[model samples]
Structures are given as structure tokens and as C-alpha cells.
Target: MDERIGLRERKKQRTREAISNAAISLFFDNGFDQVSITQIAAAAEVSRRTLFAYFPAKEDLVLHRIADHETESGRVLRERPGAPLATLRAHFLDGLERRDPITGLNDAPEVLALYRLIMDTPTLAASLLRYRENGKQALEEALRDKENLPQLTARLAAAQIMSVQWALSEDNYWRIAGGTSADDAYPAARAAAEQGFDQLAGGLGGFL
Candidate 1:
């Protein structure tokens, strides 16, 4: 039964991946606004009903990738043994070195295009904001659980951490999109990241 469940989950994951790849390719080819759910379904070789079952809307087709990241910070906090803030700081630094898109450090053409697409598209931007909020809540809960802190303290810490993280990424993304090479962008990005994390560590005390 466990094996059967694993296979079913894998199949669902494959379908979601196929659909997301098709949708992103179409979105990048044409504009996000120009792509239709039916077109995405056709590109992915799935029925409209099936596509909708996986993704609720056109915006979700793109932003689900971002939305899916809502748990990542919490996971990092929970899985690592050291201080949560230190762990998170190291995670972002690693992401920067690896050119992870979440760090906005990748200057690849597709990555640049995605940044432009999200900035230019209102629906995607709105959806992304929702995901960011969800991320904050997830982090807050994790902090509360791991620290046995007050709810208000967790909320405040989460807000600060999420804000700094977002600011760091936005700064890097704009620099990269504006023709700064990733290597050239690294110094400023690293500076911003350090400053952001330092601020987070300093402002949110008692938890690490």
C-alpha cells in the first residue's frame, strides 16, 4: 500500500511538472496575459479539467513555483540544529553562491525573463504577494514551535525576517535584470544579504 501510494504521488508530481514546464514555456514564448488555460492544457497534453484540477488559475500556473517555496524557510529552520536565524542566513548565502532564483542571484536569460514577466504581470505579482504572506506565516509558526515563544513575538520575528529576505532578493533581481553580470552583482548582493540578515538577527533577539 505504501508503494502504491508512492507511485500515485510520483505520477501526480510528474503531471504537475509537465504542466508547469509547458505553461512556463508558453508564457515565456508569448506573454503571460496572452496564454490561455486551454492553450496550456493543450501544450501539456492534459484536458482543461485536469489542468484546473492541478492549478486553480493562469496566475497559479506560474506562481505555484513561488508559492511552493512557502514552506522552505520553515523546513530549513526545523531541520537544522543550530540557531534558526543563523541557519537561514547560511541558506541564503548558499543560494547566492549557487545562483538560485529564490536568491535572485541567477542572471540566466530565462531567469531574467521570469523576473520581467512577474514584474510586468499584475496577476502574478498579486499571487506572489499572497505566497510571501504565506511564507511569513509558515516561518512564524516554525519559530513559535521551535522557541516556545509568544505568538506575537513569532509574528514580529517572521515579519522582519520575511521582509529582509524579500528586500535582499528584490535588490539582487533588479541589479541582475539591469545588465549587471551575476559575478559583478555578487558584491552588492552579498552586502545587502549580510546587512539584511544582520538586521534580522539584531532586531529579533532572544531566539538567535
Candidate 2:
């Protein structure tokens, strides 16, 4: 029974991936606005109903790639040992070393293409802002629950951490987008993350 359930889950994941890949390919070739639900559904060989079952909105077809990462900071804080800020700093640095897309240190062609697509589309950009805001709220809850911080303190810390992280990611993305290789940018990216976290530690010294 468990084996059957696992197989069923894997099949669902494959279907989802096929639809996402087809949609992204179409969006990359013809602009995001030019792609339609019916077209993507046809390309993926899935019914429009199946596509909607997996992804509710047109924007989700693209944004789903990043949805899993929205609560990463919260998870890191809850799961990792040691100071919250230090754990987050270490995680960000590790992501840079791994060329993780969430850190914006990835230089792969597909990653860069997706970044360009998001930056070029105002609607996608707006959706990303909302996603970031949601991430901030999740982190705040983690701080309040895990660290036993006051509500206001948790809120402030989460905002500062999220802002610093976003700035670091944007800087890394632009550096790679503007011609710098991820390898070449690694040293500076590491330094910036260290400094950003250091500043955070100082500012939130009492709470963190």
C-alpha cells in the first residue's frame, strides 16, 4: 500500500514537472504574456483541468519554482543549532558555495533566463514581492515561537533579516547577470554575507 502511494506521488510530481517545463519553455521563447493556459496544457500533453489542478494561476506556473524556498529561513532557524543569525549566515554562505538559485549565485543559463523573465515582467515581480512578504511573516513566527522573542522584536528582526538577505541576493544576481561568473563572484559574495550578518548581529545583539 505504501509502495503504491509512493508511486502515485511520484507520478503526480512528474506530471507537475512536465507542465512546468513546458510552460517555462514557451514563456522563454514567446514572452510570458504571450503564453496561454491552453497552449501550455497542449504542450505538456495534459488537459487544461489537470494543469489547473497543479497550478492555480498563470503566475504560479513560473513562481512555483521558488515557492518551496519561501519559508527556508524559518526552517533553518527552527532546525539548526546555535544562534539564529549565525545559522542563517552560515546557510546563506553555504548556498553561495553551492551556487544555489535562492541565493542568486547561480549562473546556469536556465536560472539566468528565469531571473530575466521575472525582472522583465511587472506582474511576476509583484508576485515575488508578495512571496517575500510572506516569507518575512513566517520567519517572524519562527522567531517568536522558537526564540521566545516578543512580538514586536520578532517582527523587527525578521524584517531586517529579510531585507539584508534580499539585498545580498539582488547584488549577487546582478553581478552574474552583468557578466561576472559565479566562481569569480564567490569571494565577494561570501564577504558581503558575512558583513551583512555581522551588522545584523550587532543591531539585534540583545534579541538574537
lDDT of 2 by residue, 65-178 (tens): 999999899988999898889889889999999999999899999999999999899989999998899999999999998999999999999999999999999999999999
Worst 10 residues of 1 by lDDT: 199-208
lDDT of 1 by residue, 1-208 (tens): 9999999999999999999999999989999989889899999999999999999878888887766577789878988888888899999999899988988888889878878889898888888888888888989999999988799988988888888898889889988888899999998898889888887778775666
- Per-prediction TM-score to the true structure, in the order listed: 0.91, 0.97
For model 2, the local distance difference test gives 0.95
Q: Which residue runs does candidate 1 get wrong by more than 4 Å?
A: 1-8
Clashing pairs in 1: none
Error of 2 at 34 (Å): 0.8
Go through the candidates in order and give the C-alpha RMSD of each one to the true structure: 1.8, 0.9
For model 2, give the RMSD to the true fold: 0.9
Please give the lDDT score for candidate 1: 0.87
Candidate 2: lDDT of 201?
90
TM-score (C-alpha, index-matched) for candidate 2: 0.97
